[model samples]
Target: MAPSKKMTFSRRSFLKSSALASGGMIIGFNLFNACKPEAKLPVDLSALNYNDFNAFIKISEEGKVTIFSPNPEIGQGVKTSMPMIIAEELDVLWEDVYVVQAPLDTKNYTRQVAGGSQSIRFGWEPLRQTGATAKQMLVNAAAARWGVDASECSAKNGVITNVKGDKLGYGDVVLEAAGLEVPEDVTLKDPKDFTIIGQGKGNVDIDKIITGKPLYGLDYKEEGMLYATVLRPPAFGQILESFDDSEARALPGVVDVITIGEKVRAYNDSGKNSWTMPMSGTDKVVVIGKTTWDAMKGKKAIKAVWKTETALESSETHDKVLLDLLEGNKFNTRRQDGNVKHAFANADKVLERVYESPFLPHNCMEPMNFFANVSPEKVRLVGPVQTPEAAAQVVADLLERDLEDVSIDMTRMGGGFGRRLYGDFVYEAAEISNAIQKPIKLVSSREDDMTMGVYRPSSKYKISASIKNGKITGYHLKEASINGNMYGLIPNFFPAGAIENYQVDTANYKSNITTGAWRAPYTNFLASAEQSFFDELAEELGIDRVQMHMNLLDNVKNNPDANIEYSPERLQGVLQLATENSNWGKTEAGVFQGLSVYYCHNTHVAEVADITMEDGVPSVKRVTCAVDCGIVVNPFGAMNQIKGGVLDGIGHAMYADFGFVDGVPKSNNFDSYQMIRMGQTPQVDVYFIESDIDPTGLGEPTLPPIGAAVANAIYAATGNRINKQPLINNLEPKEKVLG
Candidate 1:
């Protein structure tokens, strides 16, 4: 591939710089500083023996290939799969490639985040180019040695050979390859030639994971590091009024207790230039001790009084306000495609429904935790962070140190989902360590993590559609939620551009309860609202649900809108594949089925649920999914993501929800907040669409449609239209009425 103009940092300059930095041994490139000119490495690059190659492919003298994965590995399997992409293009043996997690260096790496399913989508091409560029250098080296044209030579399995029979192993010419000038252009192997991309390669850390090796942040330990737990506000709207830590301090293992303070800002408070980083949460008291258990005990021993503001908001009030907004006709129009008023007036029948989704907590297997060692000279942190670059910035800003002085080492996350994307936990650890002048490990108990952590915002959707002669005439979606609003509701989201008379309106209710991006974010609830409406429309039109969606796709395909976002063909592809794979419409007598399709994160996914309730509770016996993410990078890994996404979505829709009463989270642990158990998890069968298009994001696309699929399946079984979420608690299954 002739280095696309998109690649400003050419491979030639990269290899030359690598050779100059390490005397022609290391093959690495630093795009961090190239992207951010302000953030430069403090070390003298000219004097160092080896420059840091943020994401590099190094060929050791023994022919072993090492590829550094720059993104954080939060169980999305990027740590292993990203390296496979590079190795596939490098034409090396999969067994010979070793993957290493790169450290947090903004000067050496850019976009070291794990959320938004962007890791694979972002790394696909650039990583392949890195490998292709390296392979070309090896081919050139071998060609020179044999005195043959480079075009006449080919490299495979780390061996280079010319048509004349001159051959050389990559190891035999390592020095020569490193010495050779990097080629300006290189060719990437076609997908048909790929040996690793679509293959089922086990995770590189599978051994460490299964053998209970120290990989997660909770497993991290350091000398002189004290364990800490924060006694945050009893509720979101409360703050630490006072605390008496005398009894706790006298405990045997209790080290010290420090208070975490916060400065609250209004929703419109963005004009100020003095703010470095927004406060993570309300102020709190943190107890430090020799061990985690000791810290837990000390926290219990401590007496603290929280200022539970009587006027503080609660979920009850937020829901009431949102319900009022949904009931009212006033709205802030986000987008309007045509004359919805005229279309509704001319319609044959009108149908309207209000759907509500509760706030959700990301119950990662391992609770929030981080280890930090802060001193005047330097600050170091190692933990499970999805956004390492953002975490480093928070540390550097908190310590008043340069970005280069802040070192962040990302550890394998027990689970992130979307909770680890925020650096609030990292900030807490750094602040505690800095204040105590000693290394510290900050941990949040399951209760604290569930109650105090950032949460998925609860949303209310008031959707109305007008039907004319078995076809949708007009559509209007009015969404109300807490915190900041969203923008992609109109032209970007599906069914919006497809419908001619479409209007999307939004409203926000400000609150002290902090909300952040959960997996799939707005799409999670939006899909539930929109897809359920489509099912309802299908029922109104006396047609099959899948066929109704197909008819709309046909309308979108034939009468295309000005700014259509999703591909009708891809959506149709997955829908048809899902039905075919799930044996849709042909199932056991007792089993009820529901189908839903969605497109998000550049991927299209259609899910079908085969459900049969047991004792008034739904049991998902099996889930069949059709995924189109351009190309499957790793078959098993991609399948696992879909499986996990399906299970996660089902778990949340069935029972996982958070409630706030008097500003304190009611569901603080598994007892109140339920997770989908293994016995309840369905057997997942996944199929991917074969295509030549580049790989897209798969981490979250499959999750959006699952809630609706399961809900619709429950409706099919019970004839109960459940408009609210957490169907286990919300849906009233009086009697089984299977159709």
Candidate 2:
């Protein structure tokens, strides 16, 4: 036994501007190689050891391997999986490995935030290396003590033993090994020999989540943090005429009332067809207070008026404005696949339909909030953010300080769904803090979160399919008018060369309403239109729904056209598994089930919806899903995401998720903007594909297809095609929607 010299080093993390903020890394596609999944080792725990990290793995003279993870634990369970990588290499019992979040630094940790579903995938290699390398170093230390060659010394279940059976617990060897420099290029476990990794593990933070621990941004509170609420414009394209904040400033707990104005260059095009971020609007009162409730109440008392220049917030204005834009009289052309005029010119059976989607609020359970303390010398920004690096950069620029002067501490996100990714809120917090010269937490009331947010832009799709005999040919999707293309990650991630005589065009019109990313971005809308249309086409061909989807996926997988990229194995498995699980061709009593499959976030998911009608209204009873996200770290967490996403899809697909008048969002609260209740939560069955294909994303992929599946089921139940969303509830068809 020897004395431990020292055991500590600062953690390393890479900080970069987010694509959601400035096109550094696109949301849907990989601008960074770090977002892709790495191949995983099989589950087998044979040869293992632990070395320099052995000190960190101290046993108190008892025994434990402290697996320090460089990634954050938001909801997805990397805090558990990262330790499993080390446990496999250390030959330690699962219960003995205590996982801890790594501290922040640039050189030590990998990409720390969770996004693009790359957590488990990117962590597979580096974490495994971290474990395996430590094991080898420990084995060397153990062999030296036993007077034996390293090869003759084997590690198993936290104990290193020589051929002669001389044993040393990991705790005993830590002190001697900490002095030796760790060797680079230490052998990593072979795919066949891996034990703990690639196996299903429970979430590391389950206790925290279940016992109502402070694991989310909403729970964060620090000394000297004040609360605040702002008055944003009621409608988009409106300007602040004037304000009377005399009453607001006099309110209890109200420290000051401040007014802000929208400044230019607050947002950049992140490059998805004029899809831009927001500039913190200065059209209202700001109530600074000792508590959130006080600040929010004070904001309501402020008297203000904003001039509605574009269109008054009215339902008729909404209808008239959207109808004129759908006539293809807009500026932004999101995507143009082929000569739509030429194709429509030669078409025989041109099936044309128009589908409308209302504006969507992100509706994260936790409201939007940010905390900032700004001064002339330094700036500190803290919040639950999807893009900490992006927020830091924005703060530095806005404060006119060096990038290093700004420090951002990212807290656990209650949910991103895409709303927390914006830097405007971060910018606003900084500005308010700078103006007041104090530490303040900018909080949004549920109503403010709805109104002030850059929502999922309202859109309408006009699709035309050219079907000829039993075998079909040409297809074209002409997206009518929308504010911003959600496919900011790629110009077109979908509707690519799978169809020969096809065209996918998008047109965006200017509106006072602001827009940003929602879950699955444009994919949810694409799936609703494309998959439902496919069902309609299949009905015309008199083909089985399962077989029809299989044929399409088969053609795409067999020859991906080399342009569009996705794992064929994953796509086929989702299709096959979902088909098998749902008993696709079987018929239920008064129920009809519809199916849809899609690929995104580097993962493939297929969903089948069981629909039933009661009292003339259709309801989703159950949804069975098959997902192949490469490797799932925490089975429970992944299932939670699948279940949550499925219900989220069902809620939006069946109800009016967004209520907008002119450019203003009408649904500001739960009463107006409905959410899926407990009664609506159907039985969800999620199946994971058996593979070691690295980790793909889980947060978003499950979302795109559920809406389409529900729509397809409605098609099966009624002779009417539900290509348009909200099911076009007027079943009697008293007066038809004139095209």
lDDT of each: 0.80, 0.65
Candidate 2 residue runs with Cα over 4 Å from true position: 1-74, 86-91, 100-111, 190-195, 198-200, 261-277, 280-284, 308-348, 375-377, 488-497, 557-562, 567-569, 728-739
Which pairs of residues clash in candidate 1, taking residues 3 or more apart in a chain or in different chains?
1-186, 1-187
The most accurate candidate by TM-score is 1
lDDT of 1: 0.80
Best by lDDT: 1
Write the residue-wise lDDT of candidate 2 on 443-515 in tens digits: 8878888877877776777667766555445666666444545552232344344545655556665655667
Task: Count the clashes in each prediction.
Answer: 2, 12
